[model samples]
Target: MRPVVFPHWFHRIRFRCKVCHAELGFKMRAGANQIKMTDIIDGRFCGACHDGETAWSVENCDLCHSGKAGLPPGIFGGHETLGPGRW
Candidate 1:
């Protein structure tokens, strides 16, 4: 699987640790959870928050799959610049 770009700072702005750790059952350590895409599409793990009504829909693959090309601006507070230098 490709690397997932989970912007913690973004989630932190809205949620606390318990929200994901205690409530959602996400392991504190990364890669501890053997998350399967089917689980998500079937409404589990990330699906708990990304079921469209909650956050961005899972069907929107790029939302989770990153580095393919183009990420939304303001994702990193818009600090990251794109392309060549200014003229």
Candidate 2:
């Protein structure tokens, strides 16, 4: 399975890890998060908050699963690339 890079900062402010990681029992490893489109459509994973409340809806697959390399655009908003030298 492909890796899904969630917007950590976006979720950090809205909810703690316990809400989805612990409560939903998602693994820390990528490909082990066990999320599915069907589940999300049924209000799981991102669907929990993205149910037209906190962020974009689950129907917008490209919004979260754009299949691009690294974090999606605007995540840092034209800032320098983040790496070992940076934070």
Candidate 3:
């Protein structure tokens, strides 16, 4: 399966950081939470807003899973970086 290319900038424009970090329990950093499909299906994590009411449902796999195969899973298309030679 392709890694989900999460558009953090998109969400940041619509919601505050606390909305997901404090309220929904997502960590400030990527890969900090061990997200599972079962948890989302059970209405946890992304499912909280993506239940087809607040946002699109998980049934749309292409929306999120748009990253190329072999790419690391995490937030994408942002300016946040660890500087040159960090990786």
Candidate 4:
């Protein structure tokens, strides 16, 4: 199975776990999301949010699946570095 690096922070804002997990019936573990190109083309998984609302579309593969170990550095823009006090 291919790796699926979902944009965690992006979805957290507008959706709850149930939306993708229970509602969409996705697995909790990594590589268990059961995503497929066919599904996306049919408006599922990445295609669901990547339809140009929350972020870039599935056509922009690098936006989510960069084929890297993790999210590229600075992608979150110091948001992870900040703490409750910083806000």
Sorted on TM-score, best first, the list reads 3, 1, 2, 4
- lDDT, candidate 4, 1-87, per-residue tens: 223555455665667768977776766654555566788767787667667776577677666555455533223322243423465
Best by lDDT: 3
Best by TM-score: 3
Q: Where is model 2 more than 4 Å wrong at Cα?
A: 1-4, 69-87
Which ten residues in a row are the worst by lDDT in model 3?
A: 77-86
Question: Each model's TM-score, in the order given?
Answer: 0.69, 0.58, 0.84, 0.57
Candidate 2's residue-wise lDDT over 37-75, tens digit each?
787778777677678777678657666765456643333
User: Candidate 2 lDDT (Cα, whole model)?
Assistant: 0.59
RMSD of each candidate relative to the true structure: 8.5, 6.5, 4.7, 6.0
lDDT of 4: 0.58
Give the per-residue lDDT digits (tens) of candidate 3, residues 1-87: 898878887887688879889998898777788888787888888989989898899898888888889987778645285423455
lDDT of each: 0.67, 0.59, 0.80, 0.58
Colliding pairs, model 2: none
lDDT of 1 at 86: 29
Segments of candidate 1 deviating more than 4 angstroms: 68-87
